[model samples]
Target: MRAEVHAYVADAARLNRQPVLVLDPLTALDCSEAGYAEWFTEVTEGIEAHRALVVLKDKECEAESPRTTMMTVGVRNLRAAAPGAMVFLDATQLARKQDPPGVARTLATWSVKETAGVAINVGEHTPQAVADRYGIELRQTLAVTTGRRDLYVVADSSRGGVASADGCNPSDARIGSYEVLSDNPETTQHLWLTTPGISDGPCGSAPASKPGQFVPELATGLLAGTP
Candidate 1:
């Protein structure tokens, strides 16, 4: 699995695209120190080679848990190994389930000061509310459709303006695409583009039309203060 992940990262980098990698420490809680160190070395080497961003999730810092100690060691190793690669800490689960709202705010604040940014899963919260509470700017809005169900992806700008929208389509709708609505910092306004898919299959897709046809129009409209 780690090799496959590294291959994907290398491929994405070769294409000049940014790839997001999510790492969950809970999955390897029982691995030996030496084994985990090997994994970390591989991950750091991949990051250095691909310039990929990694999000470390589900890291526990509880006082009495052995996992907490491992988590601390893992983070230190990652920072030491890949000091230049972008890495973000995600403690949304801890914030939502175990800690108070203040905990999330503190985490967000610290992340902004320490790493690239933080990842927050606002499961049942409004984007505006989360942005206000965390004092972060709302960066992008993504609409994901799968069959008859729809999901929205919202995140703060402090985490960088990057996100992924994916879902399985088992219904007649059969359409799978992603629309990104983002704020153009230079214009102080929002701009959006929709990249439609040609098929529902994961790899069976291409841009619905030539980018030259719509890209210019969208840019012109947004620059002229037209959404």
Candidate 2:
């Protein structure tokens, strides 16, 4: 797969040989260098000449000329090589397929405030872990998160706050022919589920004085979660 990706990148010109390969997002990527030729040809010309049912209007060529039937006459516009300092190649087999010092440079360029700035560590890693891995020092800084049980207390509670979704989105989707969508375990988890074409996933469990008011327990801290 790496060989195919390398070949395809060289041929199609995806990043223009940028150093960072960014392998995390390629979890299920399914492109092959072998398929590039067929795809490029189809995209450029072959498919249209074979499948076109009606004549297209063109200013450059007479309708009788075969070039008119080709997808792009004179190859006036379309080019396979991407136009950028970076390269981007895409092919399918239906299938196919960064970091460091760059960080120092970015931090230096931005003059990032060491004490005030906090890092967002995505996935299973803690922000502290990310900073440590990347050599970014955030002395005495902390990040609040929702998915984990970790917590730290300072003299001031206002410094950090929870970042979590306020509530679940009630599903509106249904199967074909009006079959109601059954969220099952997830549907049962919510405070209330709305009938289709009725409440439109009304928030806050649908039982309060105001129609859209935040529940009394959550009202105070929800805005902090956002800000």
| Most TM-score-accurate candidate | 1
For each candidate, how many residue pairs have backbone atoms clashing (under 3 Å)?
Answer: 0, 10
- Per-residue lDDT tens digits of candidate 1, residues 61-170? 33344543444445666677776555655545544554334444444333323344444541112233343333232111111111111111223222112222322111
Candidate 2 error regions (>4 Å): 1-98, 113-131, 136-227
Tens-place lDDT digits, model 2, residues 40-123: 333334222121111111122233323222223212212332122111111001011124333323322222221112122211
Q: Superpose all Cα atoms of candidate 2 onto the true structure and report the RMSD in Å to 1 decimal.
A: 23.3
Model 2 TM-score, 2 decimals: 0.15
| Sliding window of 10 residues with minimal summed lDDT for model 1 | 140-149
